[model samples]
Target: MGRKYLTLASALLLALCLNACGSRPGTVPPPSGGGEGEGSPLLTPASPDDCYWTAVRHESYNPSFDRTEVSTMPTEKWWADLYLNEDGTALFREVLGFGYASYLINVEWWLGADNVLRLTGEDYDGELVTMDGRMEKDRSVMLETPYGDRFYFEPAQKPDSGGALCIADLEGTWRMTGGEPGAGEKHMASLLNIERRWSDGEEGGYILRAEYYSARLLDTDTPQYETQKELLVEKREEALSDGFSGEPWSARLFSEESGAEYLAALTERNTLHLRRSDAPDGPQTVYTRSDSFLPETLTLTLADEPDDALIFYWRDPPAEVAQPLEALPMTALEKGGQNRILLVGRWYETDIQFCTGSAEQNADGTLGEWITDTVLYEGTLGIDEPQWFSLSIPEKNARLCLFMKRPWDESWFTWPITDQDPFLVSGNTFLTET
Candidate 1:
């Protein structure tokens, strides 16, 4: 009976060894060329140096409300490129397209002896996420995340010998346009000029000079150039990651006097987007390639003013008499200043009631009124007319209106008068000061 038990145990051990030697359904075996064997091509300690260019592709899946219902198609796709070196270090660059915008990520990678590739750096947002993947056959690598997502990387074509971008491309001059108030407005017109110069021996670094000018609105005269600010930016192409879709380049601009750092990205072949890196969501200024040289002198010109007819004014005194009490010029409407409205006209015999308000013209050419602080000034011509009445404007770009009461009796008549309309006039008639 003891012999029988020993034999049974030996049989069970044999069965276990056979099971371990057999391949699993979907499991990938280690490459025979790298592991210890008679004709192994790779050294005992694998080196990823020869894997020059690697392209990565990944797919992500999202489960539905009923966890069991996962769509067959992947929800999103990501692509990356990697350049590995002999020192076990690699440069990785990835492009993620989320919604309407595309974001870039650059990180450093390290390869370990056990065919383990580890990502060991953070992105621009200061978020650090590490990933581990296994290298396969010196030609490909497969990374599987804890969430079951897999990323596959294969050898890719080498980039052109000539660099994708050079400092000379950014050298010379660039013109920057587009900002808040827009062109030809009353606000100060922004004139931005950027100049780049290369150092004597360096091929990639640049000495960037930026000039900001605030000129009078729509003025060509030289006096309108009010303020000029200058900044010297140190420009270099950061090797944050391997070149994927395009070269990844960034410029770090610092003011020696202020020690403030500004971030600028080469967003396109000939375009740049710059902003304070600390304030990611803040306003970003765009600079485009320009052949024009920086102007040594700036001129100012009179900005175009809103039409005079659009300006609304109640006839002063609300009297039947036709004489001006005071001139309500457009310049009087300072950003938040107030101006009085006096009803004056020969047709003001009937009791004239006027209120100052705002309206928006629709695309169909119809006006929609947006009333704020409605104050009615009612008085009979030459009788109850107030000595003084005023209309307060909130903003320089505000559109104001003078609304008159509809004629109740047919005897009340005036030029351009209609029963259906009660509007005397409305528009952005106020002159804006720079």
Candidate 2:
């Protein structure tokens, strides 16, 4: 969930044309019903039964482990000594420029021991994440997995350098139950329902404000060259993967058929602001704490048994100069049976579309017009390190799309902030306390 390439000097080259199956070459015309849509506002007091839990399942657990023997065991760094203070084993050499290999992936699920939902840590890689998969709770129902992958624990008051301590409590209102950004590659899926407030001091500092609605699915399909000198050698390998192959992208490419609905306001703490229609002078995005975006904390020390999932720690970053993106091989996607909501990528404005589809729904609800296959992922995805992709949507209600096409220049130095990316998407909804 991180990618960067800016420090520009000079660049310009735009030429697109591809006609296949009679009219369907980068289509973008679907939003014509009325005029008032982003106005269902009202539900930010933080509400989700105020955080109630009773989901248990622990029949002597053993949900398949041996993924190559936990990939050669040994984990539990403990957030790199709670954010690396004493050099702490170099903490991956102080994060080697934040491209990302791993440093977090602890997601255990189960609720009903007086209600204790768990979320360990995240920050998979980096890309300034957030196309509405969900994140922005500093609390409603508990959430911390937007860019830094995932983190949410429910029973605190144990951190005296002891154990367990994660409480960001989601503020609420999220609905964008599916996705896939554009050309390159992005993922998404959302459905938050928070609204639990209670902040004063040590009850783990609570204050939620929930409200969700994000369906950011942009796609820019590529790969249709058979002539014109092989489409000019595939547009010079997509301009050397957008960074001029030498690593450079303080980019900008605009085109408007008139269609916008910005408003990504998280006011503080890694701030953000992009209000287009509900404008108060739109256009302002910020998020500072560099290392590409953020996510280099690794802390592991488990044995209490209930840690469930694991990958406890990781590291990579520092390793660039290999641009030219376009690799979709997981057997060209179409796995076994049902695990729906698959539209690999999308985002049209600054050019983005990796649209490939297969979303089924045929009843009275209406929504079955996605049988596509497009690819065009040239450059700038997750900066230097982090490179991991896995998808197995056996649909139990899912939607995952994360795309950010335009705007990047150190995000204008955190003007009210919100710069997140360090993604990790997991499922099978496991949480057994029986």
Candidate 3:
């Protein structure tokens, strides 16, 4: 039941190579009329007793290099899951992917006593593709297309009971929450709605619609836009093999638009965990079951005026011109029990300076000298993205200064500086007053 990863680019390359080689001898083709073929003693039809099987395919590429020569090398593998039912119906799930864009293709299959395996399925584009393969040693299935494309699959270990819950328990709407903390203001202000509807069938099929908004400016309280995607899913016990802990039942969701696969596990807390099959380390969002499917709007506003002590000055890279910006209030910090200043904004590598003493003002309204100035924090705001930061303040009413660095200039050491100036140079900075 362990999850397998594959790359799409490699899979495409393999398909191209197979097409160029031409069909091989001894490969079976599906009969024009669906029925039994001439029996083969050595390759009899797979018995219904051993109906469940898992298939896998793997591909890797490594370049061979020498002092004066270089060459490209490639390796390919194939796998699948074959399920034969007592009612004469068969199901075949083919795993495919490259990197984070991995998915499974479900196809209806049939095994002929003549050692031919017939597979018919609708691809992502809703086009039908039929193929046939010859069985080998009754333990392995080798499928091939008329274009000479071949895929091999061996028996896979059985999966454990996924959980106590069934697909019926997940047939409802859910509100999503709990992602990367301090990620950004937009992330904090956004909300997600997920609706699961079951289909009228014995296959325990369902459709999931995920609707989410991407807020451009958190301070404005308006979302930049909203996106909704539908995914097809089926209760899958094999999901337990991927080390998911929750109510035992699990499901696989396939997005036809992106051709990506996601594993969903419902926990006892009424939360559903979603993870992409290929990008295990990627962000995982938890969705809590909700009572209704109605969507909610999110609005953010400051509770009170920011204290003068909380004022900060920001300057873009090259540290040339200084701009004063107010921070957006965070509900988490407004509770007031914690002695930390939470700065939640989208920022690059930024330097923060705090003044231990109060700042004096001149007659012209310009700021005077600071009694004690110290760098409180200095580093990148987030990992690959702008995230929030919580800095412990020594005392209340301390002045804060911020300096954001622009992205590195790739052509700094080159001839012409082609790339546009870093985004931070726009003289805009995020800060909160409260």
Q: State each model's C-alpha RMSD to the native.
A: 21.6, 30.3, 18.8
User: What's the distance in Å from true for residue 65, model 2?
Assistant: 67
Global lDDT scores for all candidate models: 0.40, 0.22, 0.41
Worst 10 residues of 2 by lDDT: 226-235
Instruction: Estimate TM-scores for all models.
Output: 0.30, 0.16, 0.31
- On residues 133-244, what C-alpha lDDT tens digit does candidate 1 reach at each position? 7655454766544455556777665465323343323433344454454455563433345554444433333345665434445332221443223566554555222342
Which stretch of 10 consecutive residues in model 1 shows the poorest summed lDDT?
A: 294-303
lDDT of 2 at 369: 34
After superposition, the stretches of candidate 3 with alpha carbons farther than 4 Å from their true spots are: 1-30, 33-39, 42-49, 55-80, 85-106, 145-147, 162-434
lDDT of 3 by residue, 84-194 (tens): 444434454432111111112345555444545676765433467777775564457666543444455665554544322345445455555566533454443233344
Please give the TM-score that candidate 1 achieves against the real structure: 0.30
**Which has the better TM-score: candidate 1, or candidate 2?**
1
- Candidate 3 Cα RMSD after full superposition onto the native fold (Å): 18.8
- Per-residue alpha-carbon lDDT of candidate 2 for residues 1-434, written as tens digits (9 for 90 to 100): 12111111100000000010011212422123322212221222222222221111111223385222111111221121112111111111011111122333222221111112222333334223221111113121223233432222222121332111121211223233122333444432222223334445442223333222222221222222110000000001111122121211111111132233333322231222222234344333332212321223210111222433211111111222111111111112333412222112112112122334443444753333344444323233322212223234322322322222423322111000011111222311211111
| 10 residues in a row with least lDDT, candidate 3 | 411-420
The model with the greatest lDDT is 3
